[model samples]
Target: MQKSKSFAKYADAEAFRAAMEDDVRRGRYHDPHQESRLFADVAVEWLHGKLDLKASTRSRYERELRVYVNPKWGAVPLRAITRNGIQQWVEGLTTGDYPAELPDGRSPRPLRPRSIRNIVKVVMGGVLEYAHDQRWIVENPIEKVTTPRSWIRTTTRCI
Candidate 1:
């Protein structure tokens, strides 16, 4: 049976059963044993292998991964990262209730929702895509997550 990346680590048995149901609905499943690598290891390999990114973009992604994503999810097995966990993590970013303190030499500050979205897109999105391609997980969990919506404000000028 194949497993999707949305299966959460430490999830209850019922969650696994639900995931199996989801797999049947999707017409595919995941092998839990296939996801043995730590997320950090896969992310680093992907970062080094991507020759298409501009130096600045690559640097920014690396920094974001190191300062934010890694500290929280790096040690997790790729298959064990669930959509709910990701959503909660994203919410934590906006609520200033992050799962872990930033790694050494990084400062915590109020991050705008847009910034948080971008970090998730660039770091988590990229890593999960790579993981999916490697068949480490059946689907990219990032695709199932919801980032904060962008809000726009307009001021009316009196005539």
Candidate 2:
């Protein structure tokens, strides 16, 4: 058998090595260097590869990407994001500085839960879904982040 490549992480060298052993044994070993594509790059690939979307829908998704997703996560690597970090970022979008401006010239207000949910689903969710399909990350972190809950109606009789 060929010698396994050696690499060093700042910490967790043994754990990382163990993980690599499993990957090698399974023929799933990926070069750590090539796996470092930034989220921004993945997002671009996703946008361009989405041949099924209507022009208007694609435009809307692109706008959402620029307005909501890119500013915060564009420079981050696909694997660097964590569930807790994503949750905190979503929470931040729920209040204070990131408020949406009213079209009627009123004071800016925090994004509505539905809007936040849509942003998460459409922009962040789409990019991560693409990344997951491409195997850039072992699993999509988007699945682990919680978006603000929106109201759902259940069928019931009213008096």
State every prediction's TM-score relative to the real structure: 0.72, 0.72
TM-score of 2: 0.72
Give one digit per residue, the lDDT tens place, for model 1 in 80-124. Answer: 898889988888888777755475746566579788988887688
Q: Which ten residues in a row have the lowest lDDT in candidate 1?
A: 1-10
For every model in order, what is the number of clashing pairs? 6, 0
Clashing pairs in 1: 1-30, 2-29, 2-30, 2-31, 3-29, 3-30
Q: Rate the local accuracy (lDDT) of all candidates.
A: 0.82, 0.75
* Model 1 alpha-carbon miss at residue 97, Å: 1.1
| Stretches of candidate 2 exceeding 4 Å from the true structure | 1-4, 7-29, 98-109, 152-159
Off by over 4 Å in 1: 1-32, 99-107, 153-159
Q: Please give the distance, in angstroms, between residue 154's alpha carbon in candidate 1 and its true position after superposition.
A: 5.6
Model 2 per-residue lDDT at 137: 72
54 Cα displacement, candidate 1 (Å): 1.1
